[model samples]
Target: MKLYVIVSLWALVTITHQIKTQDNCVCEFISSEKPFPYDKLKMMQDSASNCNNLMSPQKAFGLESLLLGLNRRLPQLEDDVEMLEKEDDGELYGVLSLYVIENELTEIQAMIDKLNSSTSEHKRLGDDTAQKLEDVKEKMEELETFDAMQVMKKQQANQRLKRDLDQCRNGGLHPRPQPTKHTEGTCPHGRFLNVTGPRVFTTGEYPGSYKYGAWGRDPKPEEGKESWHWLVMLTSSNIYAHYVRFYSTLSSIIVGVSTPGNVLIHPSNPTTNTIQGPNVVLYGGALYYNCYNKDAVCRFNLTTKSITTLQLPKGTRYNSKANFCHLDECYVFTDLDLITDESGVWVVYTTNQDFGNLVLSKVEEEENQLLSLGQTWRTSFPKSSVTNTFMVCGVLYATRYVDKNLEEIFYSFDTTTGKENLNVGIFIDKMSPNILSLNYSPLDQMLYAYCDSKLVSYEVLFEKRSNFYL
Candidate 1:
């Protein structure tokens, strides 16, 4: 009986040893297929050798806690497996649980790597965006500085013009010629001869007859009224004459004669009293003329046989010598010019208030009588030396005092934008006698000029078309 009991005890001990060996085998397999490298733990140890020297204290603490927790948990798992091996049924369940934990750990590590890569790309993009914003800010600041400088330059130029106008007003300029004789009659045809030149030859000569009149098509004509009309002006003197005979377009005989009730004789001179400038515009069945040897604009009603005068600003220069002079002649007493466009009549003149710069005022009238002035715009062009000017769509174009044959439309001022353009290369192809007066007819789309003693016309070509002008 003793010999059999000794043999039983030895077999039990051998079974227990085999179970412990089986548990160890399972642990070894897991460690060999580790999701996280064992050497990474050693690298972490070296990186956190001095906690005080870490750049981010919070991040370093987190890494240290993770590594220490992993080290402690791995040893606890081994101990638990050893203890389970001693039981009859617990060994199989513990091994299956460890396999699931290993898969979960592998998935977590992959997610961490992906998150880190995304964070790095986003940071790079943010930095680029910030740099672009800074560059744009700098460019905007530069543009503002340039605009301020331009304003300063414009102010200085205006100051200089004021000083020059003062000199002109104080008898520093030459006086114009005085009239020699005054005669009242119609000038016979062919009395005022037409002088031909290259400009006239190339563009066809002037019309056979000098239609001494205000000629234009009415914007809104009356029923049965002709679309085109001409109001002829018969001069009192053969040379240096004043318009005394107002002839109707319907007949060659005079009409709307300036009786005492309608004629506003000049305060200073009466023998040769007339509108100061040659430019006369017909609008709304009325005649608009510049009368200010000082401060007045005159309007004559064709139907009512009455005259109205509108007062302009003080210190308006009227009798100054020609602002624009050529090699042969200087236009005399050209201070105010009347211009008509699609909108209506406008007075182009200069004033002391504007520092001698060109001022454009829209004519306001009611019931064929002068009422008030509309909106006014100031141009940078000095009113002194403008040879001739015309309006197209509220934009003012001026010719220089260059050679009459080679005149150019070199300056422009836009009323809407308040912008001025210089050095424009539009050449005036055909002009005669220095273009004493200029007008653009929207109806016929032609430019009309009173050159010397003749009326000439030219076709206008524009790069862009605007409805505001026509």
Candidate 2:
């Protein structure tokens, strides 16, 4: 009996040592040589208690690795949930987020399964910690059913297909699509093939005095104004301008002609209707520009000398929220860009509803002689990604700075086909650092760019369409 007691103590010590090694080894005591008396069972129980005390370190080793992986992922999941919860119907976060959460949860579930299997015969975690884990799992399940993305998707669809409020008010459900393109064959210049030659270059009268402005001939000129060239210099803090100076002829513009009776946008500089931003167009005997500190476009008539306003869509990013940018700097207050091509006049902008993507809208003159917004189309191209944009033959071409001297037109959004072309690699030779405003003239087939303090124009090369061919 004394020998049995000594052997039991030594066996307990050996079992404790083996468990400390943390190897997959089972520890148990069974005498096969003979049937032990019932009295020996109590002694074995005491031995088991001593072994458990010595092997306490083994328990930590079992769960520490699992907790580390779980620790790394839970915090990340928390961060993702916080951001996702911040989304609303106005923002666009779609099913992409669900996929990310599903991937993370799937990995965590596998770890949970392994943990359950390993701890089946023993309590690996205290009751409190296990309860906390169960709570986390429940939260994850709730997160899986989050509907913010669904709401955003539906809201986005509604906004994308919806057009101007003016059209809706004029004609109820199924309003007529606003006119965007002109007669295809009317442009004798044909489909644009390439951009070549800085056909015209001039430092306007202001020259270095102003670093940002717009210069071009009016596509729809008033009678006797067909030979006119216009220049608008943002004389106040490079953002607000009150007047537009006109040069009689192209040669006069090159010779630095002085102004005679400049068209005033507003009486006082930076007033209510004054032009804001560097992008403005002189079209149809009027100057179109973004209104001062507002998301609406203002048309200041050179003839009637009256002002008309056309408010842009809701959430339009004015006040420089969506400015054209490159590696160096962004052109400030370029949020509402106005450009002219063969297709009358168009406004380019971005809205929060569209997730900061480019939106193009047409400007129409109602029979009442007031300006009303026409059709609006949202494009997939992000507005903040490009440095400048222009329209040629009714196709919108977007450019980015290729180098200090080269600006490349790499994207085109064709509204006619409802398609976007990203490989339109047309390059512009820039004489200055950046092109603040770009405009296309159908009359001369020229592309004009307002670079820093210089006015540069390029000849648009094109192949005559087969229908328009001789």
Candidate 3:
């Protein structure tokens, strides 16, 4: 029984050792399992080490070590087999990873060099294109400047040709018409036609004059009733030559010449000879005029045959004396000023009321009583001797006799600010002989000055302003 008991104890000990070995195998796996970043092959090696320490004897555990090593290495061998699944996930490792990164960086450097080369080439191409564009711009500017110069030259040549043509026309040809022909006669349409003076050509010197020249009045267009007629005022003549029937598209028409009536008491009595006048605006309705022995503004209504005097503010040298001393124009102001489309008026009588102070007044609304005078503005120079006034762009322009040499200076002043834009100088550099009368035409956009016997016209081109500036 003792022998049997010893054998039983030995068998129990062996069973317990086997149980311990199994538990250690399981515990080794649990403790040394590979982390997520660890390679399977490397994890297998680590697991092998743990197994040897836990279950192997100092030399080698008999079958147990072999079995345990097999258990650990089996998974590593399987992992090696599945290395095809590694897929080079491109994560950091040791020297091998560093070497791979350096190679990639070298390739990137090569690509960067290519990109830089392409960029530099593109920039050079862009610079060439820009240079070509600048050349085109300069060429265009040159062409424009050349075109402008040619236009100016052409205009000057044309002016010279016209002057020569006028000279040839006036070089003397036909003898004087019979004095009987000078008798007052009616033109077609029952319009009265009267000749004020003979047509004479002016050239060199003449007697009893600062300048030798002929004086006459004729229609500007010499056509229809739509044309304007002039009541020309000549210098030598004491009266304003009233050309009865003259027609023209130009505003410088000579309708008549009459004296501005002066208030002179009769030598014998106080209230004797009341002032009378031939002064009448053909368009303005006529009213019998005699303001304290001086002629007042009177219009004779042709359609109604009724005359009426314009009621002007009273209180001047001769109160109620509506004498347009130096009449400048009697034409439509539409084309001249470019303001006809709006509420505008037809201006007449460019006169210097207070010395050289220019007075530009007009009589509008010929047929209606609703018509009245528009705004009256002041000018820069004194009106003592301004022969003509023209309005452009809401500004008043006047031609004043600078001297007896007929050297005239044209100036403009803003009606609103009452200040002068001194930039514009005297336009006349070539015009000599004093101008007897002046007028403007919107249709032609020309300034016509009647000097001596010659009728001259100046082309006036206005500058275009930007809409933004306006």
Candidate 4:
């Protein structure tokens, strides 16, 4: 009886140990592809009840190892839950802020609607009041009558005024006076001369001056005209408010001419309205200039009184801060220059693709539109190295920007022969140090220059001897 009781107790102990081992077999649960939800800390307490049944002792041992590994990572899982809770709080705050904003927007919309209704009411009342005023005016007009004596007096006064106007038109009472000529002195070759004064409005003593400006002669002067006409453009920091002066050989004074008078004012495009460069050429009864802040040329017709624009080739640089310079200083002007010679008008400019070389194009007018004839040429030197350039006959002459007191004409390009010569050594000693403009006149055989805010003329000695066929 004692042996039977001891065996029974040992069997019971073995069964209890097996049951406890089976309960801890959680390998299937821990090895799942999906993660266990540790955010729900209450659910984690019931994890043991959700374990799969053990198939073998080895399987149970593997499950026990997996559960041990998972137990070690419980602290990390708790940290994750805390982070999730913080994110939830942030999202909740954002939603609350959005709700508040929506409410404010609703109130603002309601106020706007109310204001609109009030405005409509006021507008209706104003319309009614206007109608009543119109009716009152009509009633007053109906009651008014014309006076015969007053009418007769008005007719007599009108007749007298008409007679006076007719007499004025016929030059009966007032004889038409002829324009008086104020000749200070005559320039050489009967050229109209002007005293040194500012052509543009400036702050200091040099108001209306062309210190850094451009001047050129009319390429096609009118027939039977004794003197040549020249156009001068003033330079300013403000590119839009540029001033132009019309100088004729007939007048000794520089007349300030605005758009529609000297230049055509561009209505919608302000960039094309003003002239920025120091190169204005008069050709075929039209003034050609470099448009301000644009890579195009502007043609202002003197007869038609209109402006036309001609687009230049792509990559042509103009209106840039980089201007011609020499040893003393650099003059900030335009990159594109309009030049006219005995042949016609040509545009001188530089392009990025040309590798800093100068490009020239012959311009022609057809049907009131300016067109390029595609007769283009390339110069040997870069445009930046040239201080000033002008066309004589069909040849282009370039002066050095350095040693302005000693004007050295070092470069020349012949459009006819397609030959470019450098270091020609031709010099003009009479030019000032600040010679912003240099133009050769084919008519007077003279070189006109705007040097140091004064107009100076130099006689061309080579005009008769040159082999140029103008």
TM-score: model 3 vs. ground truth = 0.34
lDDT by residue for model 3 (1-470), tens: 68999886665443322225634642221222223333543554564455444432211212222233234334533553355246445554444545534543443343345345545655665566566556555654444454534775688789999877876776634322221211122212121111111111112122223221122222122233333432322122222221222222121121111222111222222132221322211222122222223223433333354434454333322321222222443221111111110123324232325432444444454556533556665454544334444444345555554443333334556554666643333344223344544443433334444454443344444333221200
Best-matching candidate per TM-score? 2
TM-score of each: 0.47, 0.59, 0.34, 0.50
Model 1: number of clashes?
1
Model 1 lowest lDDT segment of ten: 195-204
Model 4 TM? 0.50
What's every prediction's RMSD, in angstroms? 43.3, 29.2, 48.7, 42.4
lDDT of 4 at 14: 40
lDDT of each: 0.52, 0.74, 0.35, 0.55
Once superposed on the true structure, which residue ranges of model 3 sit more than 4 Å away at CA?
A: 1-237, 240-243, 248-308, 317-356, 359-362, 366-371, 379-381, 385-387, 402-406, 416-418, 429-432, 464-470
Number of clashing residue pairs, candidate 3: 35
lDDT of 2 by residue, 1-470 (tens): 68999997775454433343566766665533343344544544554455455344334433443444455557767876776667633444735565556755665675566556646534533444456546555654444355434775687677866655655676866442232332232245666667765666656465567888988889878897775788888899999999999975554455454434387766799989899999999888889999998899999888779989998888889998999998788899999999998778899999999998999988998999788889888899898889888877667878988887778888888777767877776677676778999998876777878888777778777776342200
Per-residue CA lDDT of model 4 for 40-94, tens digit only, reads 3334333322222112222333223223323433443455455555655567765
Q: Which residue pairs clash in candidate 2?
A: none
Model 2: number of clashes?
0
Q: For residues 79-155, could you state the per-residue lDDT of candidate 1 as single tens digits?
A: 54565565436477767656644543443343345335544654664566456446544654444354534775688
User: What value of lDDT does candidate 4 attain over all alpha carbons?
Assistant: 0.55
